[model samples]
Target chain A: MNIYLRLVYRNLRANLDRASLFFELIFPLFFIFVQGFGLNGIVPPFEIGNGRVISYSLFLAAGAVTLTVINGGTNAGTQLWFDRKNGMFEQILMGPFTRAQYILSIIFATLIIGVAGSLLVFLFAFPVLGASFNPSLSGVLTIAAALFLGTVFFGAFAIALSVALKSSETFQIVSTFAFFIFLFTSSVFFPATSAPSAIQVASLANPLTYTTDIFRAGLFDAMTPTVSLELGILALEAVVMFAIAVIVFHRIRV
Target chain B: MGVNQLSRLYGDKPAVDRVSFDVERSEVFGFLGPNGAGKTTTIKMLTTLLQPTSGGANVLGFDLKTEGRKIRERIGVVQQQDSFDQGLNVETSLDIYGLIWNVPRTERKTRIEEVIARFGMEEFRKMPTVDLSAGQRRRVQVAREFIHDMDLLFLDEPTVGLDPIVRRALLDYLKERVHKGLTIFFTTHILEEAEYLCDRIAVINQGRIVQIDTPENLKRRFGSARAVEFKLLQGSSEALASALSSSADVTRLVQDSGTGAYRVTTTRPESVIPEIYRLAERHAVTVSSIYIAETTLEDAFIHMVTDDENGRETERGLG
Candidate 1:
C-alpha cells in the first residue's frame, strides 16, 4: 500500500507544471470548461441566469467525471510506452516485486488521478460558471460510487491498451478514436434521450455513458435511465476491463 | 538463485543462447561482454524481465516461470538506463525505491538517511536529479540497490558514463558490499573492469563466449614475450646479425626502416640486455632503446584472438 501511494505521489510531483491555466487542473476539468463555453454559446443567456443553476452545474460536473476517466486512463497509459522506449519497463519488471504490486501501483495511481481530476472539474464548474453544487445526502454518495467504479473501468482499459500498443503512434491513434467514441456516444455532449436512436444504443454499450449519466441522474435528478441499471453497467465494465488488463499485462515480456 | 540453460529469442535469433550460471551466496560474479553480446539479455532472463524461450532459471530458489512473483521479492536490479523519477530530488528518489521495496515505515526514514550518508550525498540530497551530472545520478542509481540488503543485486553496465575515479569508487563500493556478505551479478563491456574486479572473466564477442578464464592464467597462456629493438648506425648487418645469432638468445629478426634499427624477440630478456652491449662493442653499431620490456594485457588479448597467420606477426600491433 505504501508503495502504491508513493508511486502516485511521484507521478503527481513529476507533472506539476503546465503551459496553460488548464495545466493547474487535470485535462478532464479543462475539457469541461471548454464544453461550458460551448453551452453558453448554444443556449440563451437566461438559461444560466435562471433557477437552473444546479442543472447546468451538474451537467458540467458529469462531463468532468467522464473526462476524468478518459484522460486519466490515457495519461497513465503513456507511462508504459515511455518505459518501453527508455528500457525502464524491463528495469521495473526485473525488480524484486510481484506482478500484482506493479499492476496495482499503476491502477491506484491512475484511479486517484481520475477521481481527483473529475472532482476538481466539478468544483471549478460550481463557482466560475455560476452553478450550484448542493445535492441530497444520498446524491453525493451515489456520485462517489459511480465515479469510483468508472475509474476502475477506464483505468483498466488504459493499461490493457498500453500493453497492446507496439509503438506510441498506434496508441495515440487508437486513443483518439476511442476518445471520440466516449465523447459522442456517452451523454457527455447532451442527454441520451436527445441523441439519435443509433447514438443512444451506442451510448448504452459505452461504460463512460453509464458512469456520467448515473452521476447526473442521482446527483441532480437530471434526465437519465434507471440509476440501478446504470450502476450495474459501470460495475460490469470495471470487471471486464480489469480481467482483460490483467491478461495483457501478464503476457508482457519486457 | 539459479539459472539453468536459459535461452531468449529476439524475433527468430536467440539473443541469449543457452546461458547457464549460478550466483552463489555473497559472491560478485562479473558478466563481461562486448556491446550486443547479450549480457543485458541474460540479465533480463535471470531477473524475470523476459521469460526464457526454452530453458528455465531461478532466483533465491524460486522458479522464474511459475513463481515469478516470489522471484521478484528477493533480488535488486540496476538497469543501464536511468529510471529514477527525475522530477524528485536524489533523496526523494531513494525514498521511493525503499518505499516500493515495502521497507517498514519505522526503518524507512533511517534507511533513507543512511543511504544519503553512505553515498556521501548529504549535500546533493536536496538537489533535483535533473540538476545533477551523469556521475551523480549514477551514484543515486547504485545507492538505491543498497538501501536495503536484498538477496541478489543485478547491475547492467553500472559504470557506463562514469570517470575513472568514480568508476574505481563504485568498484570499491561493490567490494566493500561483497565483504558485508552481499551477492552481486553485474555486466560490463570494459575489459579493464573485468581484469580489475572479476574473479574470473568471460569474454563474449558476436553473441558467443570466446574465452573465460582468470586474467593471470589467460596472460600466462596467451601473452607473448617482449620485442627487442636496436639502432644500426653505419654498421654491417652481417656482423650485427652474426654477433646476435651466436649467443642463441634471440629469434624473430627485422631491420628498422629508419636509422637502420634492428628488432628481435627472445625468451632470455635478462641476459639479452648485457649481450646487446657486447654486440655493440663487437660490431660498433649503435644500441638504442634496448631496455628489457614485459608484455601488457592488451597484447595477450590480441594475440589470443587473432587468426593463426596474424598470430605469427602479432608483435606488429605492439611495435
Candidate 2:
C-alpha cells in the first residue's frame, strides 16, 4: 500500500501542476462554454423523448463533463507510455512493487483526476448554464458511481490500446481518432433516438451512449425505463475492460 | 552465487550459451565483452530481469525460477542504457526510488543527502532530469540505486558517459562499498576499470566464457608475449622480415605504416631485442630507436576474443 501510494503521489505530483491545470480545469471549461453557447443558438433543444425539453447547452454540459473523464483515462495511458519510454517502467519493475501495483496506481490516479475534472465541470455549469445540481441521494450516488466506473472503463481501454501499440505516435493517432468517433457515435450531442439510423446503430454498440444516458438521467432527475439494464451493461463492460487491462499489463515486457 | 550451465536462447540462437561461473561473497566480478556479447543477457538472468532458457542458478541461496522476487529484493541494478524519470528532479527521483525500496522516510532523507554529496550532484539536485546533461543524468541514475540497501549490485557499464574524475570517483566509491561487504557484478568494455576494480575477470565472447581469472593472472597467462618495436633508419626491403622470421622466439612481425618501423612480438623480448639489432646490423641497416613494450590487458582481450572467433570459424569449416 505504501508503494502504491508513493507511485500515485509521484504520478499526480508530476502531472497535476499549473500547466496540467490549464488542460484539466480551464480547457475543459472552455470546451463547455464553446460547446454550450456556440451551438445553443443554432441547434434546436433536445426533446429527450419524454415530453420534457432541455436546452442544447445543458445536454452538452453533461457530455462535456463525461468527456473530461474520458480524456483523463487517455492521459493515464499517455503517462504509462512516457514511463516506459523514459525508463521509469523498468526502474519500478526492478523495485519491490509488483506489476499489478503499478497498473492499479495508474488507474486510481486517473480516477481521481477524472472525478476532479467532473466536479469542476459541474461547478462551472451552475454559473455558465444557470443549471442546478440539486439531486436526490440516490441520483448523486449514481452520478458519482458512473464517473468512477466510467473513468476506470476508459482508463483500462486506453491502457489496453497502449500495450497493443508499440510507438507513442501511433498510439496518439489511434486514440484521438477513436475518442472522436466514440463521442460522435454516442448521445453526447443529441438523443440516441434522434440520431440518424446509422449512428443509432453505432451508438447502440458504444458504451458511451449508455454512459451519457445514465449520467444525464442522474443529473436531471429524468430516469429512463431501461436505466437498470444500461447500468448493468456499463458495469459489465467496465469489469471486462479492467480485466483486459490487467492481463495486458502483465504481458508487457520490460 | 553459483551458476550451472545457465543459458538464454533467442529463437534458435543462444544469446547466452551453456556457461557457468561462481561469485564469492563480497567479490567484484567483472564481466568483460564487446557489444552484443551476452554480458547484459547474463546480468538480466542473475538479477531476475530475464529468466534462463535452459539451465539453473542460485542467487543469494534462492532458485532463479522460483524465488525471483526474493532475489530482486536483495539486489540493485544500474542498466547500461540511460534511464531516468524526465518528470522528476534529481532529488525527487532519488526519493521516489527509496520509497519504492521501502526505505523509511527519515533514513531515506539521510541516504539521499549522502548519495548526493558522495556523487557531487548538489548543483543539479533541484534540476529536472531531462534538463540535465547526459553525464549528470547518469550520475543521478547511479546515485539513486544506492538509496536502497542491497546485498548485491549489478552495474552494466554504469560509467559510460562520466568524466574521468567522476568515473574514478565512482570506482573508488564502489571499492569502498565492496569493503563494506557488497558483492558487485560489473560489466564494461574498458579494460583499465576491470584491472583496477575486479577481483576476478571473465571475458565472454560469442555467448561463451572465453577466459576467467584474476586480472593479473590473465595478463600473465595470455599477455606474456611482449612487443619489440623499433624504427629503421633506412633498410628493410625484405631482408629484415626474412631475418626475423628465422628466429624461433619471434611469433609475429609487422612493419609500421609510413614510419619505417617494425613491431616484433616474442615471448622473450630480452633476447629478441638483441636478435633484432643484430639482424639489422648484419643486413647493413641502421637502427633509429628500439624499445620493449609489455603487452597490455586490452591487447590480451582482443587477442582472446579474436582467437575464439577464428577457432569457431575453423570448426564450422571442418564440419
Runs in model 1 deviating more than 4 A are A1-3, A6-57, A82-87, A127-138, A166-177, A222-225, B105-123, B205-210, B224-319
Q: Write the per-residue lDDT of candidate 1 for residues A12-97, one digit (tens) a residue.
A: 55533233225526555555676667675565432211133344434655667566677777766765565566454665666655
Candidate 2 C-alpha lDDT tens digits along B217-259:
8888888667778888783548888879779887678887777
Candidate 1 reaches a DockQ of 0.38
Look at candidate 2 and give me any clashing residue pairs. Answer: none
Top candidate, metric DockQ: 2
Candidate 1 per-residue C-alpha lDDT over B238-295 given as tens digits, one digit per residue, 9 for 90 to 100: 7767678766666455665655666666656677778877877777666655654455
Among the numbered candidates, top lDDT falls to 2
Candidate 2 lDDT over A124-232, as tens digits, reads 7756688766788877877887888888899999999999999999999999899889888998777888888999999987878878888888888777678778888
What fraction of correct interface contacts does each candidate retain?
A: 0.60, 0.48
C-alpha lDDT of residue B151 in model 1: 73
Q: Give each model's clash number.
A: 2, 0
